[model samples]
Target: MIFTTKWYETVEPAGCKQRQSIVKALGLALGLLFSGHALSQNLVTNPGFENGASGWNTSGTTSAQIIESSGRSGNRLTHWSADSSYTVSTYQTITGLTPGTYRLSAYTIGGNTDDATLFASNCGNQNSQTAIPAAAWGNWTQVVLDNIQVTGSSCTIGIYTQNSDWTSIDDVNFELQSPPPGSGNDTAVEILAGKGFNYARIRLLVTPPDSYALHQDLDYVIAMAKEAKANNMNILLDIFYSNWWADPGQNWAPAEWFNQDVNTLENTVYNYTRDVLNQMAAEGVLPNMVQIGNEVNPGMLWNLGNISDNGWGNFVRFTNSGYDAVKSVSNNIPVIIHYAGVGSSATSWYASYTNNGGKMDAIGLSFYEMWHGTINDATTTISSLHSYFNVPVYMVETAAYWTSSDAGSTTSYPQTKQGQYDYLFDLTNAVKNINGFAGLFYWGATWTQSNNWLNAPDWQDDDAATRSLFDSNAQVNPAASAIVDAGGLSIRGVDISEAHYIESNGVEYLDN
Candidate 1:
């Protein structure tokens, strides 16, 4: 008998329950889609802040001022300008709500604030507050805070800031989530398995105090890998090799590796990589493949390891150190070098790396349709890379919007749900048509509305990947079905099912 035990992924709180509950609600809704009825009514009055903050209780030295027609949805929004360096907060009591699960959300933009939070708390008791840190500057962002448990008939929803300046909020929403019958049968990993996705790619940071706080630490990545193993999913461990998000723009060495010479830095990479693999192995969730670094187009480790600033020799040495560390753990585990860009750009980057003796089992590319040109351009680039490197090429990062009604996307594909479905559907075919093509992995899996929620402080990319498998409400979207429609493609000896259903403790069971 194939016992398919349901496994749940636990989300560690960085600040509030937004990360934990929103993701859980979406996964739960994935199985309840066909049966349950959601009785949703926007409980908060003047949710869009269009009524000039009327119905809200404002405190502190600051005021909740209303600005006409300057919101996320192009409607009237409330602006709180902190000209003075003082603390201020605003709230509204939402009454007549039944004791049940609820989600409170708002769109906010903050600048030069010590800290800003959007929360939903019990009227009498502030201890049960479900909140998230808000900081979305330069553009508007939709902040969806789900999985709020209301034990009473009334809850206080509001925004609070301390020594903050220039923050605006709009589209405040608080709604009850009514679950359909016979839910909880499938988890997020199972839903992905059903949709022909077997690989779980997790990103790891050496010391991510600046990003994810306690969220993306080593223990968290190990927990994630163990959960993926329980679901019989393939693991692709992506090492950032930095203290924060490791891209060409913001890749910095961890504090321990700071001021180290080139040789010392190389040794640090080697030791860190080996220790990570060893830690993962101890948890019984060793990765099948490991990524050396993330999107090292300009180079990694900033001045010391960056190829552009230092030279090709230093960059190659750093990469080879990581590669050797992976092999030291187990020769069977494959190493991948990832880069962002397509066509001649990709070719030129690979040439520099390989010419300097960079060794990688496979090549990964970030082929966002909007950023990397059209599908034709991707096809040409992939073909050229394979011909030159003679190695398997795959899309390590790719995504589109499910609906253009929110954030406007310009990939020649319509912003509608159908457009999202068709984008991945066609992109899958394009990859499969090429010789030596490996596979594709969506960039941000749980992304729904705004990509601004991804990182904070600097908050780089503000893409609302509405094309995600789930919508802003955490319910299954049409783009998810599109992935299922693509089914599975064979790469080398590994098929989608095999990838997801690898042997666990000397037993392999094909789920469904």
Candidate 2:
């Protein structure tokens, strides 16, 4: 399979038709180059400068010409040289854009001068700017001006150089940054954060170097963490204990851990957890909450930690090892034990693990309406867990569909745009009504790109076509408003109340 993970592809019958549509859509889109990227249109004309600034206007001794093979990407790049006696610049005016946010980006390989700047501006005060910091020549540097709001119907994007030697730019991109029409006007993170959401969840894996979005790697995770922090949101780092997806059906170990004994495996888990956290901390993007293993209801590390085979002893040992490792790096960060199940399955697993001395600060649950039943079911189960175990519960992963197909309307919900909104509104309200339920994280919120996985040997799962908050065009769904409107207060700190629970005559009890 070209794609490494398909956890979102429901094995249930309802998902079969949806997956088929996704596969068909992907095949058609790939044949044209890309199928799902929202940036299908590069609004800038002659953006690569292969046409030698034909679409751009110049000023003041500024000469713009294309040099073949000089671009960091593509075949040609635009080279700019200034006489240094006055300001020299080049610009292109873009029209017919609706009022919303947009981004302008370009790559430059030379220009050690500090007087260079990139800008997006036009009538009615829509001006965004980015200063290219001083750096070495010959090494390509990316310059971007993001979050530039357009109040008018059009804008002009360009680069200005004053008293600078030379700078070659390529792959200039300027496009609508807002989600496609009907999706919403704001980013999912921005919308949710405005609604008082205090944290964002990011999952990481160790293998498949080129997973879509490079989500499994540390660099991507850290970058996401930085963005979350900038949004005033905390982070939940979910470490999937596998080179690929680690779920109930399969929990394959990383290549380095293969052939290792129980003791060695334990050490590996401990050290890996500690080092990952340490790196995150070093980058100043440490998570407030970390899940040692994702959906570890079946246990982790395969047979050794498999609850069905080795029982709770081995599972608890592995859990505690990870817990201790997390503490060794950052003592204050809360560790969570995530699992998939509700009702007796949830209660039974917790009972066994806690009895065997498994240590976790919180409990994370993956609750999907298709698999976990109704809203009432989730609230009731969460309430029961909190009442019994006295720990905070988070719906770490959940998503509902807007339309059943890429363009068709048919779904478990209303299948209309509003139906999508209502589902999330109801889900958020239900989670908030539960005392111990903190918040919910919609899975695959920004997976709107296509890749080789969409080709033959298809896994038949493309989230951008279904559960993602964005549509195939990368527009935010109306359902995103539910999160935008939900004023979630941060409750991520230590729950002192949980520590005060009591037990009498073998009956565990807690009074809030």
Candidate 3:
């Protein structure tokens, strides 16, 4: 009867609704995964941009720069005009090339308005367009310059400010390619495996087993856990004190405990949490991460500590006690505090809560397109929030499609594939201050049809919905692909940054 017991791991008849549902969903996902495309390691490396070569600028260049005799420890030490800038002093050499069709480009960073140019021919054959300005800090940004002909052996290449002023230049590179390529999955866990995703965030509904009123969410958890282990995943069990949903508003105590005093009930929460965690401590198993309560903004475990006057005290007691119990059982696991808020203003939110002494290991935010607004909106919010909290923020729970493609009268962006791509990028970009960022977790890898628990007619899931990286039909959506495929979700986990991530070459991967 215990959750980790695997008691229900039987290979039951394929005809059962539950089993059938899983198989169908898994198959659809597989079909879509295999059908997904892949990205090529399209990189550009410049042969120059080092040691201020002799014939570099005078050969044909723009100058508004000087060089620094000393460089940074982990970075290239170089300078342009003015005190120092990435733009301004890009040595310019213009070349002429015969008429032809081709894609040309360079990856740069730093100069927000710097525009490096790749020339066509020496007659200044009129083929110099603005290369997107880039300023290198401690990272990389690849910029593409498309369609140009190499009529002569070489023409001219120049790096300069957007307006031909002073700027800085750090690491520079060049590359020629048709386009970038991307990959797909062929089975359950296959694609996710490919994406270097090595963990899963699962939710558990802690209920007395004898209570038939409990959510079968436990059933879903076990099913997911087995699959997760099979995929070599580390789990983050989000245990909600409620039999169903638990949040600041309704941290419903178990039905049996309704009559119990707040003190006794609070102890019950601690004891029950410890009991559950202890039971799950087999095979080096215990949640790698656990969230004590869902969203405790207004506070949780109501009644005696109903957030009246000494609400903070009560909340602290409940949480600290819960924390003590968890630590007593397993001292190493990290606990997260989650919340639902608009990304538009993370400062005003966390400044008010976290700054006020709310105990939490990490700050978690749920940025849903339906609620928090655009991808850009969410991103800007995170950027500001990070500065204020000086703590990490996880794009904890987010989903795009309200319904499978109905694109409700909602204001969600794109409402299609392009929209999905932009939304994901927006999130990643929003958390540019990456080191402290954790990861983004999609709320539902769920699909609904007819009138089941998951089915919500009002919830339109445009194939564009960036929920599970795959749709209800099991097709690979852009979100999942973009995650590991982009650059390994640095904000998530390090495991996602390796080659042969989830799986490779017709075999599964080990939990590295």
lDDT of each: 0.63, 0.62, 0.48
User: Could you give candidate 2's per-residue lDDT for residues 182-248 as a string of tens digits?
Assistant: 1343444454455455677877777533333332455445645655566677888888877767777
Off by over 4 Å in 3: 1-191, 208-223, 247-249, 304-310, 343-357, 402-409, 448-468, 491-512
Ranking by TM-score: 1, 2, 3
Leading candidate by TM-score: 1
Q: Encode model 1's per-residue lDDT on 21-86: one tens digit a residue.
A: 232222333221111233367888887766666787766644444456756766644435636554
**Clash list (residue pairs), candidate 1:** 36-180, 401-467, 402-466, 402-467, 404-415
TM of each candidate vs. truth: 0.59, 0.58, 0.52
Q: Between candidates 1 and 3, name the one with more favorable TM-score.
A: 1
Tell how far residue 225 is off in model 1, in angstroms: 1.4
Q: What root-mean-square deviation over C-alphas does model 3 reach? A: 26.2
Ranking by lDDT: 1, 2, 3
User: Can you tell me which runs of candidate 2 are displaced by over 4 Å?
Assistant: 1-196, 212-214, 405-412, 449-456, 484-512
Between the candidate structures 1 and 3, which one is better when assessed by lDDT? 1
**TM accuracy, model 1:** 0.59
